[model samples]
Target: MHVGILYSRIRRDEKLLLNELRDRGHEVEKIDVRKQQFGLDRMTTDVSELDLVIDRCLATSRSLYATEFLDSYGVTVINNPRTADICADKAKNSLALAEAGVPTPNTKVAFTTDAALEAIEEFGYPCVLKPVVGSWGRLMAKIDSRNAAEAILEHKATLGHYEHKVFYVQEFVDKPGRDIRVLATDGEPVAAMTRSSEHWLTNAAKGGKTAAFELDETALDLVETASDAVGDGLLGIDLMEVGGAGSGEYTVHEVNHTVEFKALNDSTDVDVPARVVDWLETKAAESDAAEAPIA
Candidate 1:
């Protein structure tokens, strides 16, 4: 099978997957989304040569057209474009999780700056401020003070991208020690690790340290629940324990569709790439089964 990994540049995790596919005798192509000028015509022309596409590109509104084009052309993406679209929006993820009966953090989204301030006050300080659409913990802050909240809003506004766009703020959960990163494949927990930080934020991008953690039943359930809610082939569930929301309860902080697996591989006994390939094979087989003709 010819596989095209649609990423900007090949990272370590992508390299690992590439090696795995090569070992399995699959033809792999690297298509850097950033380097290519993509549109309906360009993508349809370029991607026609590949049998499948593992979408690893960090899509912005600008690059979304290409991703959508690939989607429309029925390219076999690891986690369908629609799944990425749903996970991209914090508010939408929360609402969908709620509707699916999956528990998420107490989240409040406000459009105006004043309404954002009001939400901060109401939700109380020490809340987590996140861009409605982002990844890798970018533009995420733990607002412990009213002034800090104002500053974050001002900073976001200064960008001039969305002067009046809403931001997502969630009640901060007090888990001073560490947070859990669970990668679920096909609605089952595959690998997990605990990320510890000297600072309050336990994001790996923010100088956090990762260590192996056994997936307890609760962690597995949380990961599985999030995967089911996403209804995708793969999902990365960020879970944390919080106080003050309710006694002895956990809330999901975020869900990532295109997850970084190298960190988890370092901290667990699981073969992250092998598992991903296995999951993809299962999905591919299912698709073939669905398309088989009646005898």
Candidate 2:
């Protein structure tokens, strides 16, 4: 089987998927997404022959056309096209979670700097300001005052990018020291971890430490529910404890399409890569069955 992995070199975890595919006797090609800058000639060569594509391509509006180009050719993509995963936008993620009855932090989106300021005032101080399209807690600011909110909004406006067209504001969950990441594949919760740090960001990249956690029924249900909400083959759901010492709730924070599973493998007994390989093979089998000739 010929498999294509479309991702950037900076994606350290995507290597796990590639290695697994190779181990399974698939001819895996790692297509560096940065090469598209010169042109997509690298990605455009005979993709029709490939059995599967794990699209880790971070789609900007410019790259969306390329994704559509590939999807039109019937290449099996793990999370569908960039447009299908566009709900990865934090604002949209919140809305989808709400609709799915998956508890998420109180979140709102505002267009225009004035509207953003007004939303901050409405949501009140100690809320969070985040870009709609963000990951690993990057560019996520905790605003404790009206002035700080206004300052961030003004700075964003000065940048003159479409990112400023809307701002995501959510009620701060006040997670003291820990957050949970649930890794799910095909509606099954595969691994779970609790990351602890002194800082607000508990991502492993920020020097946070990880430990294994039980995938209890609630956690499992949350993982399955969030993955379903995102409509992806595999997903990583970030859950944070909201409220204070006495009363709190576990709320969904983010749904990641392309996830890092090193910590996940270390934290659990699950074979992360093997599970992904199995999912890919099942997809391939289903495809073959669908294309079989009828008597």
Candidate 3:
């Protein structure tokens, strides 16, 4: 099978998948988005011949556009453009979960600082303010008081970008010093891990400690629901404990597309890359079958 990896920079997560694909004798094409030019009528690479293209672009904007271009050229890409479109923004991620009846943290979006202030006040102190398009916990503020809320709102209102003005506020769930990251494919769990930290932000990118986690039935159910809500690709379904610490109840906060799993591979015995490739091979076969000439 021929696979094209779409990336700007190849991180460890991408390296692992690349090595696995090579070791299995699959032909891999490295398509660097930076070096390529794309247009409505043309693109740099012969994407039509590739069995699949896995999007690994670090920037959300690049990932969305690159996949969109490939899809327009009739190439198959994992975590399709439609899924990327929905998962790329925090507001859309939250709405998908809620609309699917998945238990997510209470969230609200406001266009102006005054409206945001009203939302923050309604949720009371210690809620979260997050950028609409971001990851790894960057620019996420825990607005702990009226004074802090006013300051943050003022700062965001002054930023020139429209996204900065689009305030995303959520009721902070008091997680018990940890949260869970489950890497799933099409609503099925590949492996799970708990990211623990003393600080409020427990993302692995924020120095969170990780270890393998055993998911209960309820957690599994939410994982499946969240995956379907986001249209189910290679997803990172994030959950926090509800009903108190270690109480078994869970609230899913977000679902990630282009999910990084190097930490997950390190902390668990699961052959993460191999499992992901197994899924890729299945996807490739499906694409081939769908496009095959009729007898």
Candidate 4:
């Protein structure tokens, strides 16, 4: 099967997938998203021969638009555009998880600084203020006091982008020292890891240490529910431990599309890329069977 990897830059995560695909003898096409022009009806680069296009675009905007255009051309893209659309925005992510009856942190959204400040006040101090669209722990603040909340709100209000104006506030979970990141395919857990950090943001990209984690039945349930809520695809589901230590309860925070797995691969015994390819194979075969004429 021929697979197209959509990326602006091939990071370590992309490199792992590429190597695994090549080792498996699958034809791999490296499509540089920065250099590609995706038209409403067509893309400048031909994808007609490809069996599947895996979206690895680092930028959310690129991932969202690229998959949408590819879908329009009858090309199969993993983590479909609608899933991308919902996962790319924090507001949407929060809503999906909550609506699905998943135990997510209490969240509130406001469009203006005044309304945002009100939310912060209502939630009280030590809540979190996050950008509506971002990842890797960027532009997130743990507001500790009313003054701090006011200052952060002022700063966000002055920012020119509309995304900044849309404040996403959530009650801070008093997790221990780590959070779990589960790499799942259509809600099936491939591997799980714990990211530990001294900072409130425990993202691996934020310099957290990673180790393998075993998921419990409750976690498995949340993973499946959250995946369905955001629609299905390859995903990284984040959960923070709640209640007392070893409480065996979790609150899912986000579902990531175009999830990175090099950290997970290094920390766990699981063959991350190989399992991803296995899922890809299944998807490709499913696509083929669907497109085959009824006879």
Candidate 5:
């Protein structure tokens, strides 16, 4: 099968996938979004013969626009534009999960600093202030006091970007020194890991130690529900144990669309890239069969 990887830079995660696809004798096209021009009617890069296009662009804006353009050109794109649209924004991500009855962290969004402060007070101190669109725990604040909240809000208000002004305040879950990251495909678990750190943010990218985690029945159900809520594809569903590590209860905090799994591969025995490639092959075959001429 022919696969086109839409990306700006190929990281270790992308390398793993490329190696797996190549080893399996699948034709791979590395389409650099930075180097390509996407036209309304067509793109400078020809994707007509590709069986599938995977959006691996590091920038969320690039991922969304590229997939949307590719989709408009009649090419099959994994984690389709609709899914990308919902997952790229934290506000949309939370709404989708909540509307689907998935237990997520209590979140509030406000347009101005004053309104945001009201929300922060509502959730009380030690809540979190996050950028509406970001990953790897960058620009997230754990507001511990009124002073800290005022300072952060002032900073964000003056930052000038609309996204910064749109404050995303969430109730901080007192997770027991760790959080779970489950990689799933179409609501099914591919592998699970726990990211543990003394610090508040426990993302692997934020220097959290990782270990393989076995999903309990409740976790399995939440993972599936959260995946479906975000329009499942290859996703990283992040959940925090409500009370402690062994607690059966959980609150999902985020679902990532362009999910990076190199850390997951290292933390678990699962052949992460191989499993992802297996899913890709099935999707591509189904697309081909669906598009074939009728007898």
Candidate 6:
């Protein structure tokens, strides 16, 4: 099968996938979004021969636009534009989860500093303030006091971007110094890991220690539900324990569309890239079958 990897840069995660796909003798095309131009009816890069295109652009804006354009050109892109649209924004992510009845952190969004301040006050101290569109725990604050909230809101208000003005506040989950990151393909678990750190933000990118985690039935259920809520594809479903690690209760915090899994591959014995490739093959075959000419 012919596969196109849409990316701006070849990070370690992308490298793993590329190596895996090549090892399997699949024809792979690396389409760099930075150098490509997307016209209304077509794109500078020809994707007509590709069986599937994986959206791996690091930048959310680039990922959304590029996938949308590819989709409009009648090319099959994983995590289709609709899924990308919902997962790219924090507000949309939260709403999708809540609307699907998935237990997520109680989140509030405000467009102005005053209204945002009110949201912070409502959630109280020690809540979280996050950028509307970001990953790897960047631009996230654990507001421990009213003064800190005021200052952070002030800083955000002064920023020129409209996203900064759109404050995303959530009730902090006292997750026993760790959170779970489950890599799922179409609502199915590939592998699971725990990111533990002394700091509030335990993202692997933030220096969090990692270990393989065994998911209980409850966690398995939430992973599937959260994946479906945001339109399943290859996803990273983040869940925080409501009680403790062994506690069955969990609240999914986010579902990532362009999920990175090099850290997950290192933390678990599972051949992460191989499993992802397996899923990719299945999706590509399904697409081909759907497009086959009728007898």
- List lDDT for all candidates, in order: 0.76, 0.75, 0.94, 0.94, 0.94, 0.94
lDDT of 3 by residue, 50-140 (tens): 9999999999999999889888888888889989998999999999999999999999999999999999999997899999999999999
Error of 1 at 127 (Å): 1.6
lDDT of 2 by residue, 1-295 (tens): 7887877653546767777888778998776666654233434456767777776765544234455556667667766654344545777778778888999999888888898888889988899889887666778889999889889998987877797678888888888688988877766877888888999888976778998877666667777887787775667788886664223357888887666778888777888888877888888777767767987
**Residues 1-295, model 6: lDDT tens digits:** 9999999889999999999999999999999999999999888888999999999999999999999999998899988999999999999999999999999999999988899899999989899999999999999999999999999999988888888999999999999999999999999999999999999999999999999999999999999999999989999999999888788899999999999999999999999999999999999999999999999
Candidate 3: misplaced stretches above 4 Å?
none
In model 2, what lDDT does residue 8 have?
60
Q: lDDT by residue for model 1 over 12-106, one digit each (tens)? A: 88889999999999888888776676565556247775666787766645334555777777666777766777676788788878777776888
Q: Which residue runs does candidate 2 get wrong by more than 4 Å?
A: 36-43, 58-66, 82-84, 243-249
Ten-residue region with minimum lDDT total, candidate 4: 239-248
Residue pairs clashing, model 3: none
The residue-level lDDT of candidate 4 at 49 comes to: 89
Query: Tens digit of lDDT per residue, candidate 4, span 1-295?
Result: 8999999989999999999999989999999999999888889789998999999999999999999999999999998999999999988999999999999999999998889999999999799999989999999999999999999999988888989999999998999889999999999999999999988889999999999999999999999999999998999999999985468999999999989999999999999999999999999999999999999
Residue pairs with clashing backbones, model 2: none
| Overall local distance difference test of candidate 1 | 0.76
| Candidate 6: segments with Cα more than 4 A from true spot | none
**Please, what are the lDDT tens digits per residue for candidate 5 over residues 183-225?**
9999899999999999998989999999999999999999999
